[model samples]
Target: MELDRISNLENDITQKIFSYLSIKEAARTSVLSKNWSHKWIVPPCLVFDDENGLSTETIVSHVLLLHNGPIDSFKLSSRKDLDPNDIDQWIHYLSINSIKEIIVKKRNRYSSSYSISSNLFSCQDLTHLELYNCLLQPPSTLKGFGMLKSLHIRRVTVTRDVLEEVISHSPLLEKIILCKLGIRHLKIDAPNVSFLELRGGFEDVELENTINLVEVSIDQKRGSTNSSSLLKFFFKLPRIERLTLQDSFLEGANGSLPKKLPEPCLCLNFLSISIRLNNLEDISTAMCLLRSSPALQELEISVQQDQHVADAAEVTGWLNDKQNRPFTQLRILKVTGFSCVKAEMDFIVFLLLSSPALQQLEISFGRKAVEVVDFSWIYDNQNNGAFMQLRLVKVTGLSGSKAQANFIRILLSSTSTTLERLTLQPAASAKELWELFKLLGEFINRVSVPAVVLEFLDPSNSVQESDDSSSSSDSDDDIGF
Candidate 1:
């Protein structure tokens, strides 16, 4: 006697409601109603993952045969049993159906990689394309993806010409991510690309015409190319807002670095730079980036761990030049791999006093997840800045030494004006959490401002997730990237 309202709904409404459910979950709903079972409106986004025991070849063929209307997105995540010939056929069908996105992550035991055929290029409706571990040969008649906005190619074997053709032809492309391309030279002259994440080896990078590019991250997978100077390289990215330099990309700057870029990154807002604390060149490069980013609001500095850092006495005088000026806009700062060495202390202290507007500070350091023993670290006692703007201070992997306790004591004592929260995570599950508090006496509760929140985090939190996702080719942890 009851009417099947859901089943009787229009096709457009059905698609809208069912689009949120996964393909398998949508299929499971077939038992709810026989009418729904007979005329199932599949979602436009199809992900034929062979991660489970599902046979993609048969399932995909049937889906295309039975399903009507356009497929907006398709991802063929292959672990095995994905025939190369099947790819061309599926892409051909998808091209006719106006597919908007294609993600082919091929990991086949039967073949080295799936050679992407001309059928894919026919999908003129594609806007987002990602191909990993595949062979791409640009079709002579390639008209390019005129509507494409995001292009991600990782571990794919596409010639430099073909790659450039794809980038240059995609007039609307905004995000370009390339990793381990194995290409020695890359000339990116795209007019509209805004975000670029380039990793792996690039002998020469041409970016003169990318005037609209805003965010750029480059990590040299191998050693520096020594082909481009820092001045010449950074001058092109005058509008970059966020920058991350990893590995040896900024090591020597191809020879020498100017004291400052003639034209600084006037728009830069966030910077994450990796460096070695003892290496003069690395420190110099790190400081160069800081000084150039006059508008910088957030900064993350990751130091190379497990090395003998030079004594602060040796590095402090050279570092006292106050090169970290113009960080008046800086609000947040984070440092990782900070051993309680005097050099690390000096750098932190120098930065702390430099940014009068600095608000939050987080420091995480330790070679391992073991309880910290007092290193008997000694530093020249200096008065802390007013820190009138500093609010939140979090220190992880802290070695519970009287010296470290005194360091916290000084920060707490001076931040009486604006300090709000203090979070401490020990190197391991150390009983020294209590001992450190005892060493501070009743000073922890004496902040003159409003209540100061104190939190003791688990030491395990100090050890970052051990999963090496950056080097993983198959991991989809960073889907957006």
Candidate 2:
């Protein structure tokens, strides 16, 4: 009966059983029945996590003894202190087994050192590889790993030449992610890469070939002398459809800008960027980016606390140009951490005025109090019936200040006819939200439009409190919002 049950168990069930059991427990399963004895020899996948009281050497030995067939996937991670050679041996063993996918992660314990042999890159069957805090030496020649499609390396020491060699060899590569690496220069030769993400300090990315790229997210290093150099390479990609730049410094020490901005001829339909600068020239660089994006339909911009709007006049001026700079196709706009300063307000107001087709506007105020700026002037001056197309307005992080409340009242009075959904965040109480909803409901009833949907997205409940303790001292260039 036990033999029958063991035979009836599928490979997935057997693997799940092995996942929870230690080497001893799994070996003990062999004695359960004659049919179960050798069943562990050819399991489809192997996973070893040292969290369960198993020694790294013992786990590695058990894996080598039982792994007899081509491994479809292998994951080896150690939570306990381990020797770097133990990891290298494990990787070497998996490579010999023709593993298709491999993931190895060492716990961030006391700054441990680990290294990978260049031979590991020659694994012909490897299609995906990810390493965390593993020291790697570039292969002498990018010989094998011809099937590799994705590679992610974090906190690794990588040389620029090796990086270029890897890219040149991986012709079918689709995605690459690098974080906090020592690589100073990156030149991607793969024309078929679809997605790329780079995050680190002062690394210059110089791509030699035009890629058939679709999406790119760059969180540039702050206060780095190489910021402009990095941006130049990023913008050179020929066919990027989506671009996101976060917490990047664009001006040099003497406020000189890069000679040219990245220009993608394709209509950029979506863009999200956060610019942090102390000078006016930095704003010009940002405006240059926006002006180059002719087909942007959805845009999200986050300006930091210290970044003033007064210095960003060039960007606002470009936006205010009704004939040349009108966002005729823009449909959605979201601005977060806004201070309602004249520069910020003017920029938004200009965008609102220019975006004749805009349907939704979402803004989150940062501080507690402010003088209300009435946007009723927009309705009075709107041409081509642009104000009539406005449908939804959402404001989050409200503090119940008179200025904020008055601003909400002005929007309600002005666009109530077409406004369909209105949402507010951080409302003091459910009762308060209910009362506000009632007042807005009555106002909407008078307008004869559909009942305005009033929602209270309480930031206290939704926003994670634990994140508040974490410092934003790290460069914000990488996270555009």
Candidate 3:
């Protein structure tokens, strides 16, 4: 029961506990007993960061010279001022010791980045590699990574030939992430890759072969000049199950729908589109994708604020096409930044009428509507049994107007047998948030649907928190290898 008895444990168990401590912390254990004098010299994983006052070169060299065991993971983080030659020697040493994984990150953005040392590529035992803000130049005699499974490169400079050589050579490569890189064209010929993400623009991306690809995400540079290649790249990939496209990539493809719809992507199940909503063309391009994916089960849309209002007349004509019906497999639709424009409401009404199998609709709107939408179409569709199976409806930033309130009431009453939960997230800003909270009672009193629960969300804190949480998770995933 005494804390002092911790040292009395078996030697292997004692060393295992010390492995969790930093090198400096492990070294301090020497003072407790002579049995631990040189025990800290080699305990497996080696991680050198800026927390220690000494330079990365000094700490890494000191440990590598004294360490005796094979390293499972080696991570070195430093500012731009660290000596490149020393890094080369450390990696060379790691190669000889059978290092399994390596991570190198540059902490300074303005400083020059170190070109990766070629000797490290000789580590045939390595399975995962992550590099940030570095230059990559594979060795000329490169035999390709034989055992690598995951690779993440961010802000790294490497040519299309080198990247292709790396992927084509690695027989076991499965997951990869390329972000903020300098490249004009990308051609991947990996056969076993399942998850791939590209966060920058390239003139072209030719997927020679990725038969096992399951998830893909593309976030292009804003107003990218090489947008034409995006659509071509999308068509080339083997049918992926999940796809995410940011506004930066979509802006280039706006209003550029092909004369005939692309081949039906039966494998697609989840699709996410983030658009700025600058015009009706944005909406059209998104719908074009939806029509192509007749089997999509979930759709998420984020509408960024744009100065221009949607042209109601033109949008109506676009949706009136009879061919746009029968999104037969769609079940969930999530929309963010929903401003109550006439055209926007019309778009939602079209979804209600078309997505007969739809089970959930979640919308997060703005503080004020530019105009009151005539949603009498909802009642007409409900009377015709269009939403007989709809189960959940969530509306954020609810308008205080009687008409919008009535829309919700009628929507619930029509689907009362199936509807379970209705959630509302009010707009940001203190004044509007307060007004929504005060008006919550008036709407609750009007509800008549049995067993239907109404829930209000305080987005004042959640809106910003959720965004930050998402960003942090993405960063972690970039290094999760």
Candidate 4:
């Protein structure tokens, strides 16, 4: 038989080949020769997600014992619980070899949470750390992760004080995400931290010193309406450029909300916030941030689907308030999770009227409309003073409802002169698709904008919005302009 070219390749090229193999598969290559033996034993990355816990643990231990080179990353994922003691030994060994990244994900969350090895904190060269459904108990001697740049903890259990200690002590930490953690009274003092995302039921949040903090997203299960806490938190982010606050985050302001932040977010160009039509405090907070964000260009508002939608009077009063007029610099406005509420429509009109620089408007309904959505108010306002700057309007989550068709009808009438594109995305299922397209197509024939191309995103072929910030859960789906 002729000699194999792959086997005779250079060590660098061989290393590349071995990188694609699993640890077990790579280890089996040792039977080839002594040269192949050493390559398999020293893989640059080790990812263990085997179903059999005992075997996985034994194999990992055996691999580490025979390992002789630096590993770029180590990931330990398991469906069945593995002994934390074994994990400790592995972490200690990886620490000595200068591992740069560590990810431990426990798939079975219904069972007991994984107690991570304290030795993990000793990995001084670690730059990225992600722990899911794990408990982090750093030793008292732990100073900080000197080279750590990103720390992500999801469904992890750590004391408020311990987490604070880990975050504040890390000098190089830039990105921190604490999601669905069962802890409270979180305090962050990361001076170098730029992106911060907190999504949980935190009783309190304190930002001691986040001077470099810019992008922030908070989707709290329950948000306090305390003015002092809100003010103190907002005052620290002078350089915030992008912000998204969703769910019940800062839902109510305890009857006393700040009119505006003293230090404006002058650098902020994108702002996303949750709004409750009935909650004046929520509206007030949204307005406060809008007023403070002078440089804001993109605005996204998620209208909470609350049954107690505010009356037209309350929406009118807030719109008429001089201080509440928002987004003078706003170019793109996106509204989502809207049900056909009188106040919701009124608020949309208010935004259209207030935002003179607005160019693109997008609205995604939360549910199929039960009644026809009246857009006569906007149709009449078109003659008085229209959004001349408006260029594109998109409406998604359509189910061929009379309400949606009527809204599109009004949009076509209002944007006939300036609109370049009118995009509609139906939320109907495969069975209902034909009916939806038929209704919309017929409606467009009767009520269409002049010379404007109509676009429809077929549900079957539609691509789901990615995790990118432009199409984030808190922002509008990124339809490229």
Write model 4 residue lDDT over 5-95, tens digit each, in one string. Answer: 7557787787787767767677778888655657787668886757433488888898888877778888877666778788888888888
Model 3 ranges off by over 4 Å: 1-5, 8-43, 51-54, 322-324, 365-388, 393-417, 424-434, 455-481
TM-score for candidate 3, residues paired by index? 0.82
TM-score list, all predictions: 0.87, 0.77, 0.82, 0.83
* Winner by lDDT between candidate 3 and candidate 2: 3
**Per-residue lDDT of candidate 1, residues 1-481 (tens digit):** 8987977888788777676655566667778777688444466877666655778798778777777666898887766646778888889999998899999876542356668878888888889999877889867988789889999888888889988888888888999999877787778868899999877777678785798898888776325466244336578987889988766566636346666767889999998876667666667767877888789999987766425556555677777877446479999998876656666666777787788889999987554443335343333633554566789999877767665677787777778667889888887645556657786557755545457788888787666522211222334323421
Better of 1 and 2 by TM-score: 1
For 1-481, candidate 2 gives per-residue lDDT tens digits of: 3347766788778878876665556767888777788766666566666656757677677667666666777766665556767666766777777888887766552366577766587577888887766677855666636888888776777777776777778777888877777666667777668888777565567666646777877766556545656666655666777877666544331243442344543556887776433245555676666666767788877655442434444544544563346767789998766655545655666677677798998877654343546544333333323355678888876655544554566567657668888888853422344444555566667767556777767666533211111112232222210
RMSD of each: 3.6, 5.7, 4.5, 5.2
Score candidate 1 by lDDT: 0.73
Q: Which pairs of residues clash in candidate 1, taking residues 3 or more apart in a chain or in different chains?
A: none
Q: Rank the candidates by lDDT, best first.
A: 1, 4, 3, 2
Q: By the lDDT metric, which is better: model 2 or model 4?
A: 4
By summed lDDT, the worst window of 10 consecutive residues in model 2 runs over 464-473
lDDT of each: 0.73, 0.64, 0.72, 0.73
Task: Assess the local accuracy of residue 60 in candidate 3 as a C-alpha lDDT between 0 and 100.
Answer: 83
